[model samples]
Target: MIYFDKVSKVYPPSMVALQDISFTVEPKEFVSLIGQSGGGKTTLLKLLLAEEKPTEGTIFFESVNVNDFPRSKLPELRRRIGVVFQEFRLLSNKTTFENVAFAMEASGRTPEEINRDVPHVLELVDLVEKANHFPHELSGGERQRVAIARAIINQPDVILADEPTGNLDPLNTWEIIRILKKINELGTTIILATHNKSIIDSLGRRVITLEKGKIVRDDKEGRYVL
Candidate 1:
């Protein structure tokens, strides 16, 4: 459902984030991106999300070139993809339910839809009991679960998770991984960019490794060999 064809990104002066990278992620597949910091994993994801324009080649979402999307239509493009970040960017003032409901509201969903979907997604992430609690009241794992709940509440076709477990302990990290696998099993395509070797090794999924802005390896049932 997603393809990057000979894509490259270069910043001002001389910073090359990606160089002639090409790959395709099929529908409902779980793909893991592994590399050291500044290895271009995040840059590749930013290009896919249309957060930054590519300096060369093209990125395609299904059959449409993502860079060809007009500014006014970017929101529509973004709605098809969900994102979970390491920081767990929740609203400090909103309760767990409100946080998830806000995503639906932003998409112009009806109140009835928000009410129905929010609870279901929270349950999927195993956060139903904490729905009324604020972010401060939850543990690190619970807070990340809330973030995941919010990301998937829209039932997005693809989820881009960047270091979603970076802030958690090993136990919490595994918890988040399990939830991500569950989401993928339910038919949502997941592209996970992480540095956790154990998580990637245990997953035994498709792995893409980058080195200095280029793909070094693309393996099915790969390990975290760097």
Candidate 2:
């Protein structure tokens, strides 16, 4: 389980990005983090990634405190979690297959593992035909699928999607959502941070709503009321 205990982040000059936030995410759970922009949605995700330090409180991944990890060990922590972002952050020079392969390579996977897993995941994302296409050669939805493919190539314990469908049309948005749901159903945990009401309402999963850096609502089988 992942636990955020009384976590808070305050920037310089009295800006509070998060305030006394607390929550727990069980294994294989699909949770949505929803709120308006500047409501600490991004900040909270960053803290989980150890990209920023919390001003107070603790974040626990299983038993260890994420904040206590040394810089060298941070990579180990991050390797267990996958992150997908609004902008499909792919290498402009690499093809779809190479883009996903690069992630496994960075983690020191062997040639055999890379050769075996890359095609399998590409097929999972229905990108086998576009495996040789570069980012510039693909559509926005295809690029995002490549991003998602890269994120899941390592089979991380959880996937954190930050406004992943923000740039796609409704058709593509649902496509991405379906892919995420498939991943979750396959036993990977998913923490989706999005503001699309239709997506949230359609999900009917756990919703944790934040407003001005405070959690205003949390419900199972939730809809996007805010």
Candidate 2 lDDT over 1-226, as tens digits, reads 8999999999998999999999999999999999999999999999999999999999998888999999999988888899999999999999999999998998989999999999999999899999999999999999999999999999999999999999999999999999999999999999999989999999999999999999999999899988
TM-score of each: 0.97, 0.98
Q: What 10-residue stretch in candidate 2 is worst by lDDT? A: 73-82
- Best candidate (score: TM-score): 2
Pairs with steric clashes in candidate 2: none
lDDT of 2: 0.95
Model 1 lDDT on a 0 to 1 scale = 0.93
- For all candidates in order, the CA lDDT equals 0.93, 0.95
Look at candidate 1 and tell me the lDDT of residue 30: 98
Across 45-102, the per-residue lDDT of candidate 1 in tens digits comes to: 8899999999999999999999999999998888889888889999989999999998
